[model samples]
Target: MDQEKVNEFLGRFVADLAATEAAGSVVIGQRLGLYRALAEGPATPEEFAERTGCHRRYLTEWLRGQAAGGYVAYEPKTGRFSLTEEQAYCLADPNGPNLPAAFLIALGMLRAEPRITEAFRTGEGFGWHEHHEDVFVGCDAFFRPGYAAELIPHWIPALDGVDEKLTAGGRVADLGCGLGSSSLLLAEAYPRVTVAGSDYHADSIALARKKAAEAGLSDRVSFEVATAQTFTGTGYDLVTMFDCLHDMGDPLAAARRVREALAPDGTWLLVEPNASDTVEENFNPVGRLYYSGSTFLCVPNALSQPGGYALGAQAGEAAMRELIAEAGFSRFRRAAETPFNVVYEVRL
Candidate 1:
C-alpha cells in the first residue's frame, strides 16, 4: 500500500468516527433537553445544570465536547456555552427543522449493526418494524417539521386540483404515516377532509392514534395498522406516501393498490428521498447518507418481503415515474422538491 494514501484514509476514518461520536452526543443532548435549556440563554455549567436539573460536572464535559464539535457557541471571556440562532433552530426548536432527529435515527441503526451484518452475510433481511422504537420516534421527529413547513402550503398546492378537492371535502389516505405527523397535519390543515393514517407497525399506529386524540382530531384523523400493499380503502380523493416508497418490498404492488383505492380522477402524491437518476450523479453528501441508510435500513426492509427488489432510498425520479406508470398512472410529473426529498404527482 502507498504510505501517503494510507495516511489520507487514516485521517478520513478518524474524522468519520469523530462525527459519529458527535452524533451520539447529539442524541444525548436531545434526550436530556440540554439544547432546550441552553436555548434560553448563555450559561456556565452550574447554571445550565440548574436549568436542566443535570449534574454540573457531566454537563461541563458535554458542553466542552459540544463546543469543540462546533455544535454550540462558547465564550472564553464569560466561560459560558450557548446556541446561535441557526444552531437553536436545528437542535432545540421543535417547530422548526429538528435535524437531531436524524441523528437519533442513526443511533438506532448503530444498535442494530450486528444483526444487519448477519443479514448481509446470510441473505436475510429485516423489516422497518423489526428495529427498535427509537427508529420510529426519530423518523417522526425528523420528518414532521418538513411536513409542517410544506405539506399543505407547498406539496398539496403543487398537485393540480388536489388542493381544491381537499379544501371542499374529500377522503384521504396517508400510507406509512409514522406517528401520524403527516396525517394529522392534513387533518389540521383541511378541516373538510377526513384523513386516515396507515402503517404496518402496530406500535407506531398506536402512537399515531394517541397523537390524533391529543390533537383533538380523533374524528377527522384516524390511524390504522396496515402496510402499503394491505391498506383497504376506496374512493380516496387523494393518497399520499411520504418518504416511504423506496422502503416497500413491492413498490409496484403498493402503487397498484393506491391506484385501485383512488377515485378515477384522484391524485396520488408520492414523496421519496431525493437522488439523481444515475449513480455517478449522486456522489454527494445527501447521496452518502441515503446509500448508507439504504444498506443498513431501507433495503433490508424492502427485502423483508418477496421480490426483495431493494430499490433503496436513493432511487430517483426516473425510477419513480416507471413505478407509477406500471401501476397505470398515465399522468406523472415532478411536483415539488427540497434538497432532502422529491415529490411527484400521479393520476389516471
Candidate 2:
C-alpha cells in the first residue's frame, strides 16, 4: 500500500478507537449529571465537584476528556469548562436530542461482545431480553425525544386520514412499543383514541405499563407482552410500528398480522431507519451508525427468533415495499421522513 494512504487509514483507526474509549466516559457523565452541571456554567474541576458532590480528581479527568473530544468547551486562560449552546442541546437538555444516551445503548451491546462473537461463529441467535438492562433503558431514552418532537405534529399528520380518524375516537395498536413512549405520546395527543401497545419482552412491557400509570394515562393506553407476529388485536383504525419492523425475525408475518388487525379502511404506519437501496449510497455517517446498531443489536434479535430473516436496520424502502406487498397489502407509499427514520403508509 502507499505510505500516505496507510497513514490516512491509521489516522481514521485512531479516531475510531478514541471514540470507542469516549463512549464509556459519555455514559458516566450522563449517569453522574456532569454534563448538566457543566451546562449550568463554566467551572473548574473543584467547582464542579462542589456543585455535584463528585470527587475532584475524577471530575478533572472527565472534564478534560470531554473537552478534548469537542463535547465541551475548555478555557485554558480561565481554567474552566462549559458546554456550547449546541453541546447543551445534545448533552444537557433531556428534552432535546440527548445524543449522549445513544452511547449507553452501544455500551450495553458491547457488554455482550463475547456472546455475540460466539454467535458469529456458531450462527446462533441472541434475543433482545438477553441483553443488558442498559440496552432497554437506553433505547427508550434515545428514541423518546424524537417521538416527542415528531410523532404528534409531523408523523401522524403525514399519514393519510389517520390523524383525522384518531381525533374522531378510533383505535390504535402500537407494535414493538418499547416502554410505551410512542403509545403514551399518541394517547396524550388524541384524547378520544385508545392505544394498545405490545412488545415481546415482558420486562419492557412491565416498564411500559408503569410509565403509562405514571403519566396518568393507564385508562387510555394499555400494554401487553406479545411479539409482533402474535399480538392479539383487531379492527385498529391505525397500526404503528416505530423503528422496529426490521428487528423481527418474521416481519412478513408481523405485517400480515398488522393487516388482519386493522379495520377495513385502517392505515398501517411503518417507521424504519432511513436508507437507500444500494450499499454504496448508504455509506454516510447516519448509515454507518445504523449499520453498527444492526450488527450488534437488530440482526441478533432477529436471528434469535423463528424465521430469522435478519432484515437489518438499513434494509431500505424497496425491500420494505416488497415485504408489505407479500403480506397482502395493496397500497404502500412513503408518508414522511426524518434524518433517522423513513415512515410508510400502508393500506389494503
Candidate 3:
C-alpha cells in the first residue's frame, strides 16, 4: 500500500468516528431543545443549565462538544457559547427551511442497526414498520419543510392542468402518504379538493389521523390504513407517491393500481430521490445520502415483502419511466425536479 494513501485513509477513519459522535450529540440537542434554547442567546454552561433545568455537567460537556464541532461558537474569554444566525436557522428552528432533521433519521437507523445486521447475515428482510418510531417521525419532519416550501406552490402547479382539476374539487389519492404531510398540505391549499392519504403502516395512519385533526383538515383530508397495491376508492383526478415508490415491495403492481384508480384524464405525480440509472453517475453527496438509507431501510423493506424487485432508493428516472411504462402507462415525462427529488408526470 502507498504510505501516503494509508495515512489519508487513517485520517478519514478518525474524522468519521468524530462525525458519528457529533451526529449523536446533534440528535440529543434536537430532541432536548438544547439548540433551541441556546439560539436565544450566548450562555455559559451554568446559565444554560439553569435556563433549561438540565444537569450542569451534561450541558457543559455538550456545549464543549458542540463548540469543538463548530456547531456553536465558543467564547474562550467568557467560557460561553453561541449559535450564529445560520446555525440557529439550520439547527434550532424546526419550521425554518435549512433545519437539519436527518440526525433523527440517523438515530432511527442506528436503532435499527441490529435488525439490519441480522437481515444482512440471514439474507432475510425487515419491514418498514419494524423501524424505530422515530424513523417515520423523522422522515416526515425531514421532508415536511420541502413539501411545504414546494409541493403546492411549485410541484402541483407544474403538473399540466392538474391544478385546475384540483381547484374544481377533483379527488386526490396520495399513496404511501406516511404521516399525511402532503395530503394535509393539499387539502389546506386547495379548499375544493378532497384528499385521501393511505399508508400500509397502521401506526403511521393513526398518526396521520391525529395530524389531520390537529391541522383542522380532518373534514377534507382523511387517512386510511391501506397499501398502494390495495387501496380502495377510485376516480381520483390525481395520485401522488412521494419518496416511497422505490422502497415498495411491488412498485410495478402499485403503479398498475394507481393506473386503475385514476380517472381517464387523471394525473400521476411521482416524486423520487434524485439519482441516475447508472451507479457511476450517482456518485455524489445526495446520492450517497440516499444510498445509505436504501441499504438500511428501503432495500430491507422491499425484500421483506413478496415481490423480489427491490428497486431501492436510487431507482432514478430511467428505471421509473420504464417501470411505469411496463405497468401500461403510455405518457410518462419528467415534469419537474429539484436537486433532491425527481418529479415525473404520468398520464393515461
Best by lDDT: 2
Better of 1 and 2 by lDDT: 2
By summed lDDT, which 10 consecutive residues of candidate 1 come out lowest?
A: 301-310
lDDT of 3 by residue, 1-348 (tens): 799999999998988789888888888898789999999999999999998999999999999998888889988899889999988988887777534578888778789888888888997989999999988988998899999988988998999999998888989999999999999989988999899999999999999999999988898999889899999999999999999999988999999999999999999999999898889988987888789999999999999987778998898788998899999999999888999998899999
Each model's lDDT comes to: 0.91, 0.93, 0.90
Off by over 4 Å in 3: 98-100
Which number leads on TM-score? 2
Candidate 2 residues 1-348, lDDT tens each? 699999999999999999999999999999988889889999999999999999999989999999889999999999999999999999999788888779999999999999999999998889999999999999999999998998898999998888898999999999999889999999999999999999999999999999999999999999999999998979999999998999999999999999999999999999999999999999999999999999889999999999859999999999999999999999999989989899899999
Please estimate how well model 1 matches the true structure, expressed as its whole-model Cα lDDT: 0.91
Residues 229-300 of candidate 1: C-alpha lDDT, one tens digit per residue: 889889999999998989988999999899899999999999999999989989998899989989888999
Clashing residue pairs in candidate 2 (N, C-alpha, C atoms within 3 angstroms): none
Name the candidate, 1 or 2, with the larger TM-score value.
2
Q: lDDT, candidate 2, residue 98?
A: 84
Query: Using Cα atoms with residue i matched to residue i, what is each candidate's TM-score against the true structure?
Result: 0.97, 0.99, 0.97
